[model samples]
Target: MNHKPLRARRAPEVARAHILAAAETLLAQGGVDAVQMRAVARLAGITDAGVAHHFVDRHGLLTALIAYGGDKLRAMIDATVTDWLESEPDIGVLLAKLAGLYRQGYSGLAVALHAAGWRETGSPVLEKVVEALHAARFTSGVSAPDILHTRLVVAAFHHALATDPLFGTEFRRSAGISGSRDDGAALQLAWWISVTKRALGYDE
Candidate 1:
């Protein structure tokens, strides 16, 4: 006797979540190019038509993935800011967390999306970080210049970490730093952490 395999039914949201999770895994493994629809469908345990039913096409899926990443980043920033407001702030730890997210291939995906003409109107994630830093530095008065400076600092750090996966090691080597790729990355992260801390007036 032959047995048929069972297919568990999922809610639409659940199915979309599974598809996005599968896409993220592919992105982490081999950047944006690896997140093909059929591969996503196979990894998601769904049919190609099922994947298409949700995403419509690769571009739609990728757009949703970018939005998904933004949501994740926003949540991370919220938690980090809560910790910062409630206790001693550790800028290094915060910066390291930001770097870790970029290292997970989201950075490359972001760049690719931008080159493909996908532009974000604004970043709530950046705004939250800037607000937290401003509140930490000033208790009473509002300084536009200070806020602007904080914004610039955060933007610079974001750009650096986003590009680090692509150019960090070579950039470090050009500056005469020598060792394995991991070593260069570590050194670069440490330097950025320090600079960010100092710029934010968190360093002693």
Candidate 2:
């Protein structure tokens, strides 16, 4: 298949997008502090001045990145739900996908972004994404009992990924999972998926 090449006039816009994408990855991997201008420039194969030219400053870059992430996240959830609606709509599969997303550390990034948004009194984009996520999970053909169980699963996963190692360790021990912390986390997710599936009246 022949693909049309990007126009030269669009180079600056493409570069800005690359910088934002790199910044988003950094934010996901290490929260706000990791999204340094130099690092983003390096990842995007552009100069720091190039990043600043588009975003003006680190604060400006971060503000734009959060908005980008919120839009991206909402699009992802919407696509997943649209696909489900057209095919075999399985809430269990969607829940498992959400658990996998949490396991990949997106949840930690989201927690950090939410804290920042709360303190800054802004970030309507992130707030809107969160509201949509809550509605998707709790109101999308899920029973009351299933919603309660799903919340329990989310709570457990959140505690398992908590920064307090002692709390996480104790929670893992009480849950009777054996292995390294990461392994225990995987097992916890698996168990929760089974529980959630059953709660949703799925046998497997």
Candidate 3:
């Protein structure tokens, strides 16, 4: 006797979420190139048609993926800010977390998306960081100039973190550090954290 296969029924939003999550896993494991529709569909336990139905095509999928990553990063920044406000203000921890996210293939995705004509009109993440740091500095009795400097410092740090995943090792090697070692990245992050702390008056 032949048995009919069971079909898994999920809401549209649920299916989309599953596909996006699978794509994210593939992206984290092998950059954007690995987030093919077939792979995502397989991982998502859905059909290729299903993935296409949601994202339309590869470009659409990638665009949505980038937006998804941005949302996650925003949430992380918000949580980090809340924690810093409620407890000890640790810029180093926040910097490290930002670096962690970028290193997880989101940096490459951002670069690819930008190269493909995706333009972000505003720097919401940077603005949030600046705002949080400004508040922290103001509460610590830091001078007006120092508090205002938070924007520049945060912007620089954000740029460095975003580019680090793509060029960090080669850049470090060019500066005479071993390319195979992560020591250079660690040292760079430490320096940024120190600079940020000094700028925000957290070093005192």
lDDT of each: 0.78, 0.63, 0.76
lDDT of 3 by residue, 83-154 (tens): 666776666777777777676666776666555455555666566667777776666776665545777888
Give the candidates in order of lDDT, highest first.
1, 3, 2
**Model 1 global lDDT (CA atoms, 0 to 1):** 0.78
As for lDDT, the candidate ahead, 1 or 2, is 1
Candidate 2 lDDT, tens digit per residue, 1-92? Answer: 99999745447778778889899788877778888999999987778988899999998998887767666655665565556545655555
**lDDT string, candidate 1, 145-186, tens digits:** 367888888998988988888888888889888898877887
Candidate 1 worst ten-residue window by lDDT:
136-145
Ranking by TM-score: 1, 3, 2
Worst 10 residues of 3 by lDDT: 113-122
Q: RMSD in angstroms, candidate 1? A: 3.0
User: Number of clashes in every candidate structure?
Assistant: 0, 0, 0
* Residue pairs in candidate 1 whose N, alpha carbon or C atoms collide under 3 angstroms: none
- TM-scores for every predicted model: 0.81, 0.64, 0.81
Summing lDDT over every window of 10 consecutive residues in candidate 2, give the lowest-scoring window.
124-133
In terms of TM-score, how similar is model 2 to the real structure?
0.64
